[model samples]
Target chain A: EAGVTQSPTHLIKTRGQQATLRCSPISGHTSVYWYQQALGLGLQFLLWYDEGEERNRGNFPPRFSGRQFPNYSSELNVNALELEDSALYLCASNDLGDYGYTFGSGTRLTVV
Target chain B: AQSVTQPDIHITVSEGASLELRCNYSYGATPYLFWYVQSPGQGLQLLLKYFSGDTLVQGIKGFEAEFKRSQSSFNLRKPSVHWSDAAEYFCAVGARSRGYQKVTFGIGTKLQVIP
Candidate 1:
């Protein structure tokens, strides 16, 4: 079985631009989570989506938004990207009410 | 609110030596505890978790953790360290997801293994 999958392993955008990151949860998984890992920093929760609904989000700004598709795939959008937005964005998935999550390799976003 | 703390920022151990990483959590209820490892430039992988039942749980790659309720800690341990074990370790506390609850993570502990 394939684990959570993320696309465009790496991306570069201007500070004022926008970036979209995608994720495909593992088959049978219903919850998708997004986390940001900055250089030399730990993982910070970004958003959580389940059953195509925005379940919860972290302390990020409104500029950081995302949605989950019916099929359990997810898209993370970061608008007005700032230099601090340069970090590795990770996606994880798990079956609703289940245990631990399976994570994707993550997309490294660099804003210049 | 639930939170996790991994006091140690980094640790170094020689191969073939025993290893232990500390984790402490604060929650109103029985918190779901987890240990995850991430290699350099890689994603996080579940090392082990403790929900209920036996306090001791075994994980892949010769990893083990003991959940101490009184101490409010779930520390990760390995009998023998390997070079490949060098990586970043995280301790997280999970709340009642109710479908999706926030899971808080510790700052993380970076492990270094020497030959």
Candidate 2:
């Protein structure tokens, strides 16, 4: 079985621009999670999608949002990106209510 | 509110030396604890987790962690370190409350191995 997969391995966007990152969950997985690993900020949870529904989100601003498709794939969109938005955005998948999550390689977003 | 803290920002250990990374968490109920390793420019990998039952849990790559509820700590340990062990290690805590699984990760500790 394939693990979680993410598209656009790297991205470079200017400030005030918008960015969209994508993720596909593993086979038979129904939950997708998004996390941001910023420099010196560690890994922060961005959003959680389960069964095609937004379940939970972190303390991030409203400009940071995402959604999950019926196939359990997810897309994270950042509007009005700032230089601090430069970070590795990771996607993880797991069975609903499962304790463990398998993560993807992540998309490195660089906001210039 | 749940939070995890890894007091050590970075640690350097000689090859073949013992290693221990400390992790502390604050939660009211029994928290699900985990340890993850991330290589340079790579995603995080699960090392091990502590849900219940055994206080000591063994993980892949000859790593292990002991959960001390009284001390509110779950520290990762290895008998001998290898150069390959040099990476960023993260400690995470998850709550199984309200039928939701929300995990909180620590600030992470970067390990440097000296050969």
Question: How is the predicted docking of candidate 1 categorized under the CAPRI scheme?
Answer: medium
Q: Model 2: per-residue lDDT, tens digit, B40-80?
A: 88899999999999999999999999999999999999999
Q: Compose the digit string of candidate 1's lDDT tens values, residues B1-113.
A: 89899999999999999999999999999988999999987899999988899999999999999999999999999999999999999999998855455688899999999
Candidate that would win on DockQ: 2
User: Which segments of candidate 2 are over 4 A away from where they belong?
Assistant: none
Native contacts present in candidate 1, fraction: 0.68
B-chain TM-score, every candidate? 0.96, 0.98
lDDT of each: 0.92, 0.95
lDDT of 1 by residue, A1-112 (tens): 8888999899999999999999999999989999999987688999999899998888999999999988989999999999999999999999876877788999999999
